[model samples]
Target: MNSKKLALIQTAMKLFYRKGIHAVGINEVLKVSGIAKKTLYHHFSSKDDLILACLHYREQLFIDWFKQQLDAVPAGKAAILAIFDALDSWFNNRSPAMGEFNGCFFINASAEYGREDSLIYAACQQHKSHVRAIIKPHVDAFEADENKSNQLTDSLCLLKEGAITTAKVQAKLSAARDIKPLAASLINHPLRQANI
Candidate 1:
């Protein structure tokens, strides 16, 4: 991507994440990025196009960061639980790469673009699916039954979403840590029964 286009996307992303998609105007993006209006239009046909690009950029950055955090811990159940620890760090503003916590960007996008058929909404949904996909492998590693593994993955994803939302909405900075015990129980139920 050209430097101008990348700059526009990055600027728009921070603005959108910090504020809301509808709240930030193209003019603001241009001002923050120091890119010309004509250049933004040259790179993106419309503001919606730029919004989509920003969403894509945010997804890749977030996924890469999330994967790295998971990889730092042991895999399987331990890694799955570490997700909350990662989220705690993020919520506490410890992870500078993720920027300040303003709730999940995808969640914010979905709210602004509530229509399910809209491309922006779809992009948000895709980000969520990617999150679940990242958790699935860890769940699978610990749960042998396919059905059980799928359920476990769903539970973990739900917990993650809850943590993000609570941290943002309720201003509960320890939301992630607060929810960790529930996740630990969910992930270790079988092992506990077996005394493992």
Candidate 2:
């Protein structure tokens, strides 16, 4: 992409995240981006097109950040649980200048675009699926049996989603960390009782 286009998208993303999609208009994006109407139109055919681009960009940004955090830990329970640690850091304003945990950009977009079939909503779902995909590997490695692995992966995903939503709603920065014990219980608990 051209520098101008990238700049526009980046600026629009910041405004959309800070202000909101519906709240921030194209005029604001243009003003903040400092790009001419022709240039903005040249890059994106419409505001909806730009919104989709922002969602795609956010998906990549979040997943890449998640991968880095997950990879920092060695594979196992530590790697599996690192997802929440990452979220905790996000919620705690670890990067005050960046992210600052605005309750999942994709989640915010999902609310803005309520139609299930809408591109915006689909992008949000795709972002979540990527997160689940990342967790699946750790789960498979932890659980030797394929069936057990699938079940554990689903549970972990639920825990992660729950933590995210709860943290946002309750304004609890440690919500992710707080859920660690429960997760540990699930992981430490063997799938079956031995000789029971």
Candidate 3:
């Protein structure tokens, strides 16, 4: 995409991430982004298309940042802790790419765009699955059985979601750190038999 098109996506994403998908209007995006309606329509056929573009844009950005954070730590329990650590910075708006998080953008968008068939909702699901993919490697190493690995990933994902939700609601980004202990417990569980 060209600078103007990318700018529109970024602007709209920030607005949608801060507010909500339905709460934000096309005119508001255009006005805030300083893009003309004709140009926006030229780039995206409709508001929904624009929203999808923004989701795609954000999905890439979010995953890249998340992977970077995960990479900073070795693949082990520390790697899992790295996720909550990253969430701390993200919730606190410490990342330049992410302003003060209203919550997980995908989670927020999914709540509003709940219809199973909606592209926006599908994008949300895809983003979450991508997150799981990123996390699976760390969890997989801790569990020899495939089913146990999947279960571990699911548990970790829930802890992450819970941490994000708690952080947002409690008005303290550090609240996400609470997940660390629970995560450690899961990682060090007796049944796992793997060194965390």
What is the per-residue lDDT of model 2 for residues 8-117, given as tens digits with 9 covering 90 to 100?
Answer: 88998999988789999999988988899999999899998999999888777877888888899998788887888888888888854347676777888899998998
Each candidate: RMSD: 2.7, 2.8, 2.5
Stretches of model 1 off by over 4 angstroms after superposition: 190-196
Model 3's alpha-carbon lDDT is 0.87
* Model 3 agreement with the true structure over 1-196: per-residue lDDT tens digits: 6999999999999899888888899999999999899999989999889989989998999999999999998997788889988998888878876667888888888899899999999999999999999999998776777877788888889889988888877776777687788788887892662333
Per model, how many backbone clashes are there? Answer: 0, 0, 0
lDDT of 2: 0.82
Q: Using lDDT as the measure, which candidate wins?
A: 1
A best-first ranking of the candidates according to their TM-score comes to: 1, 3, 2
> Deviation in angstroms for 36 in model 3?
0.9
- List TM-score per model, in order: 0.95, 0.92, 0.94
Tens-place lDDT per residue, model 1, 1-196, is 8988898899899999998988999998989989889888899999899999999999999999999999998889989988999999999999998999999999999999999999999999999999999999998887998877877788789899999999999999999999999899988895442332
Off by over 4 Å in 2: 96-98, 190-196
